[model samples]
Target chain A: MPVPDDRKQQPKTTADAKIPGAYEGETVTRRRFMTASAHTAGGIATAAFTLPALGMAFGPVFEKEQVRWEAVGPTEDFPDDTYIPRTITLSPGIGEVGKSTVYVRRYNDTIDSEVKDEYNDYVAITSRCMHLGCPVRYVEASERFICPCHGGVYDREGKVSGGPPVRPLDRFYTRVRDGIVEVGPRYSLNSELRRFSPRDPGQAIDGVGQYLYPSRPSIRKLPGT
Target chain B: MAKLPTTSGTRPRGTRAETTEAPATAPQRNKLQETGVSTIDWLDERTSLSAGARWMMFRKIPKGTNWFYTLGSATMFAFLSQAVTGVFLAMYYDPSATRAYESVRFLTNEVFLGEFVRGMHKWGSTVMVILIFLHMARTFFFGAYKYPRELNWVIGVVLLILTLAMSFTGYLLPFDQRSYWATTVGVAINGTGPLVGPYLSDFLRAGPEFGATTLARFYAIHMLLLPGIIAAMIGAHLYLVARLGTTAPPWIRAESSPELREDSK
Candidate 1:
C-alpha cells in the first residue's frame, strides 16, 4: 500500500473538514452556534439581576453624607474651662440609637493653640472613642474622657492621653448661629488636632495612616474648616 | 447506579414489590399507592432522575466508617434548623434601628413560640459552628484532605468563613446595647487592615459610622446575601462529596483481595 499521508494540513473551514450539513467556506456549525448563544444568554440573565442588587447594597458608600446643624444650647451653657455633655442626633429616624453624646465647651484661647479659625470659637468633642466607636464618658474630676470597652483615655483637648486610642476623639464642627451653639457633622483629627474628613473609630490619621486609611467620600468636614 | 441489585420487578422504590422481591407477576396495589407510584413513574420517565437519586444515595463507604462521619450531616441539619428559625424570626423582625430592639422584644416576649424559635436560631448558630469545626477536624486528622480531595477542603474553608460572616452579621440584628457595642468593636477590628481596612468597615456599615441604614444592611446580608451564597456552596460541596466517596480513617489499613495480592507478587 502507498504510504498514508502523514503531513499535517489545517482545515481551512468547517465545510472543508466535512462537518455535518456544512456549506462551502463556512467556518461555523449550527450546534456550536446554539451552545454559544445559550451560554451568552445565561450569563446576561445572571448579570442583569446581580449588578443591580450589588449596587443597591453598596450605594451608600458613594453617596454624599447629609449636613445638619443641631443647636446644643445657648453660648453660656458651655463654659470655657470644662466640658458639658450634650446629646445630639446623628441619624434622625432612629429613636435612641441615633443619639450620641458630645462634650462641648467654649474654645479656650490660652490652651487651644491651633490657629483660631472661624469654626473653632466653640470647641465640641465627640465622645466616640478613637480605639473603637464605643461612647466615652467625660470624667468631671479627671477632666478626661474614658472608654469602657477598652481603656481609651482622651485629655481635655480631645487628644489621646492613654491606652489603645489610635488618635484623638472625633469632633463636630461648632458654629454659633442665632446666639445658639450648633454642632455640625463630625470630623476626625490626628494626634496634632489636624482636621481630616470624618473616619470611623480605630483609624489613625497620623503619618502613613493618613494615606493607608484615606478619608471616605460620604462624610467630610465643612469646606473652609 | 448501574442497578440496585434487587430481585424485585423493576418497579421503583417505596413499593410492596421492592420489599418482597416479587416475581414479574406483580401484586395488587391500593389506589393511594397506585397514584403515588404512577406519579413518580411519570416524573422518572420524563427526567430519568431516579438514576441520579440512586447514584447520590447508594454510595459505598470504606470498611471502618464510624460515628465521626456523621458530623457533616449534623452540621447540614444544623444549618437547616438555622434557616428555618431565621425565616420565622424575620416575620416579626423590623430591621430599622428605631424598631429593631422593640421588634426583638416583642418577638421574645409576646409572639407565641417566638422565644423558643428565636432561642433555636440563636443557639443553633453556635451548634452549627461547633459541628462544622468538628467535621473539619475529622477531615484534617484523617488526612482526607490529600490529593483529589484538596478542592473539597478549599470549599469547606469557604463555607466556614461564610458561616462566621453569618454570625457577625446576625449578632447585630437584636439592636440591643450589647449587640450594638459588639458590632462596633467588630467593625473596628475589621478596620485595622492595612490599606483596605477603612473601606471594608465603610462597606460593612454602609458608611463611615454606624448610620441609619447599618442595621438594615446587616439584616440583608445576614438573611439574603450570605445565606444564598452559602446554600449554593453547600450544594456544590455535597455534589463533590457524593461524586468522590469518603476516605477511611487513617487507622484503618488498606486490605487487598487475596487474588490481587497473589497477582502482584
Candidate 2:
C-alpha cells in the first residue's frame, strides 16, 4: 500500500492511529451505543433531581411586616419562682407581619439567692444574648448568665462579668397589679443600674453605690426624694 | 463483467484498484446501499441512541449530573433556589424581634406548603454545605489545587467560610428564644476580643441586646448583605474553574487505544 507522503513528516504518536479490528472502524454495535446513552441519561436525571426546592417557597420570603403574636396564656401562670421559659409570638407591625415564638423567662430574684415573695421584684429577661444575639441561659449553679455564642458571662443580677458582652442582660419593664403580671418592651436603664451588682436594694431607683444583700426586704431608699 | 465506478474521479488511484478487485461487485454495492437506507427508516421507529444523545447534552443534564462533581452546579442551583424561597418567606417573616418568631409560625403552619419550601431552603443550605466541602476535598485529594490552580482553591476556601457564616447568621433570623439568646452568646464571645470587644458586640447586634433593632440588623445582614457578596464570589469562583479545565490526576497519562498501540511506529 502506498502511504500518503504527509504521514512521513507528521510526528509519530500512537494516539493518532485509528482503533483496530476490521469492523471496529465501521459500525458501532447497537448495544454499546445504547449503554453509553444510558449513562448520559442517568447523569442528567441526577442533576434534575437536585435543582433545589426554589420556586415553591419564594412568595413568603419577600413580604414585609408579616408576623403576628398569639398569646398562649396569662401572666399569673408565670409563678413567683424562676418560671420555665414560655414560647411567645411577637408581631412585626407591618402588613400581616409577625415575629417568631421567642421564649421569655421570668424570675423573682437572682438565681444564687432565695426566691422572694415581694410583688415588684419580678424581672423577665429575654433568653437571647446581648451580643450576636445568641440565646443566653441562666446557669443556676454558677449564678451566672451564660451566652452560648461566644461565652459572654453575666452575674446573677444580669450584669456582664466576663466574655465579650459590652452591656448587661436586657431587662423587661414589668407590672403586676391585682395579681396580674404584664411585660412591656425592653428599655435601657441608667449606667449604674446596668452593672454587676449583688444587691438590687429592693426598690432603690437611684442609690449611686449601696450594696443591698439578697432578700433584704427593707433596704434604705436611695438618698434624696 | 467489470462494473462501472460511480463517482470514480475523486477516489484515490490505489484505493480504487483495490476496491475493483474486492467483493464490492455491482450487485453487492446495490445491496449495501439499499440496507443503509432501510436501516435509517427502521431506526426512526424506535428510541434510537441519536435522540438520547441530544437529550443527554441538554435536557437530561439537569437530571443526571447528581454526582459529587456536580456539587458545584448544585450549589449554584441552591443559591437561586434559596433566593426564590426566601422571597416567599420574606413575605411572612418579620424583621423585628417582637414579631419575628410569630411570623415564622404563620409561614410554617398557616401558609400552603410554606413550611415545606421553607424547610427545604433550610435543609438545602445544610446540603449545600456538605456538597461544597466534598467538592473541595475532591479538588484537594486530586491535587487540583496546585500552582496555576491555587487561586481556585483559595476561592473555594472563601466560599466554604461564607457557607458557614451564612448558616451562622441565619440561625438568628427566626427571632426565637434559641435565636435571640444563642446570638447573644455569640455576640458576647465576640466581645472577648480585647479592647474593642464591647464595640464589636455592639456593632454585631447594633446594641447591647437582641431586640427590635438587633433583629432588623441581623435580618438585613442575613438576607440582603451576605447573599450579594456570596453570589459575587460564586461568579468569580465559577469563572476561575471554567478557565482552568478539570485537572487530571497528576500521575495518569492518556494512552493510545489498543488498535493504535499496534500501529505505533
Candidate 3:
C-alpha cells in the first residue's frame, strides 16, 4: 500500500522539517536537545548510585574469598576405616550458623581411588550434600553420608552411591600441619572424583555440567588443582 | 461541639452569644466545625486531594460486584497489618546473625506485647499469602484478567512473586535452626538453575556459603527492597483497577439497551 503524499511522515531533523521555526542550519530543535540532555543527565545520575549499590551487593560473586586452614584434631583421632565429625567455621564472625561439620579421616589406601596428592593426605568430606546443600550426617553403620532434607546418599568414598545427588559429595583440601590434621578451602568433585572449582550444592560439575554450571569467582578450587 | 484549635481572627469567638436557634442566613461560624472545614478547604485548595479521594472512593463498580470484590482490599489490609507489626518488631528484632535467634527469643519471651506482634507478623504472612491467592483466584475465575486489564494482571503477578520473595527472605530473620537450614536449602534450590544458578546462589549467600552478611541481606530485601516494590506495584494495581472499572461476574450477562435491541430487531 503506497502512502499518499499528504499522509507521509514528516522529516526527522529540524533542518529538513517544514515547520515555521525549523531553520536550514538547525539539525535538532532546542526542546529535543534539552529533553535528551536532561534525560541523559538523569540516567547518568541514577546509574552513579545504582551501579555501585548493585556492585556492592553483587561484589561477593566476583570477590575472592580467603582460604583459611584450621586444624581439627591430631592424625590419630581420625581413623581411615571410619569418619570423625569436626566443626569448622567456613565463614567467620556470624557465630554458630557459619560453622559447618566436615567429616574427616586419614586416607585409606584400599578405598581411595583419586590419584595420591599432597592435599588429600587425609580425606575430608563437607557435610553439605551434593543435592541441595543440606547438612548430611555420616551414618556409622552404613558408612554413608545421608542428607535429611532430601534423600541423597553418598557412599564411603563420598561418591554418589544412591538417590538424588548430581555429583559426588564436595571435599576440602586436607593437610597435616604440626602433626594435626587441618581442613582448608572446599572443592567439588565430578562423579569420577576429578577435582574442579567449588560449586554450590545441586550443580553438577560433570561433563556438560561443568560448562552449564560454571565455578563462581569468589571461591575457586585450589590453584591448578 | 468538639474543641478546635483556634486560628487568630477567622473564627467567631462568641459561642455563648450564638443561641441554639440562630438564624440559618446569619450563620455565626461554629469555630469548632469551621476550623475543621477551613483546614480541609485550605488543604483541598492547594492539593485538590479531595477530588482524587472522591475519584478513587466513588468509582462506578460494575453490576454483580459482591463480597468477592473485597479480596483485593483484604490483601491490602493484610499487608498494612504486616507492615505495622513488622515496624514495631524491628524496634527490638536484631538482624545480627549471632544475636538474631537470641533477639527473637527475647522479643517473644520478654518485651511487652512482643509475642502478640511477632505472632501477628508470622501468622499474618500466611494470611497475606492466602488472601493474595484468593484475590488472584477471584481475578482468574471472573475473567477480570482479560483485555485492557492484562497489564494489571502482570503487575499483580509481580506483586505475588514479590510477596513470596518477602516470605522467603522473612523466613530467615529469626535465624533459628529451621531458618538457617531452610535458607540453605532454598538457596541451593536456586542454584539448581542452569547457567546463572551458580552465580545467583553466591549472590544470595553473599559468597560460596552463608556468610556474615546473609541475614542482614535477607532482612534488607524483605523489609526494604521487596516492600517498596510491592507497595509501588499495589499503587499501580489500584490505579488500573479504578481506571478500568471492573468486570461484572461471569453469571451477569450484559443487558442490551432498548436502542440496540430495536436496531437488532
- TM-score for all models, in order of appearance: 0.87, 0.45, 0.90
Q: Candidate 1 has which clashing residue pairs, if any?
A: none
Model 1 TM-score (2 dp): 0.87
Q: Per-residue alpha-carbon lDDT of model 1 for A117-158, expressed as tens digits?
A: 888799889988888788899898998889998899888888
For each candidate, the DockQ is 0.63, 0.07, 0.82
Fnat per candidate, as a fraction, reads: 0.66, 0.13, 0.92
Q: How should the candidates be ordered by DockQ, best one leading?
A: 3, 1, 2
DockQ computed for model 2 against the true two-chain complex using alpha carbons: 0.07
| Model 1 per-residue lDDT tens digits across residues B1-265 | 2223222466665544434433455544554566676677767766889989988998999989999999999999999999999999999999998888999999999999999999999999999999999999999999989988899999999999999999999999999889999998899989888778877888898877678899988998999989999999999999999988899999999998777786634
RMSD of each: 5.4, 21.0, 4.8
Predicted candidate 3 versus true structure: per-residue lDDT over A130-169, tens digit per residue: 8878889999999898988769989999999889999999
Of the two candidates 1 and 3, the one with more favorable DockQ, higher being better, is 3
Q: Candidate 2's error at B28, in angstroms?
A: 40
- Please write out the lDDT profile of model 2 over residues A33-80, one tens digit for every residue: 799999999988876765443322222222222222234346657655
Measured by TM-score, the strongest candidate is 3
Worst 10 residues of 2 chain B by lDDT: B57-66
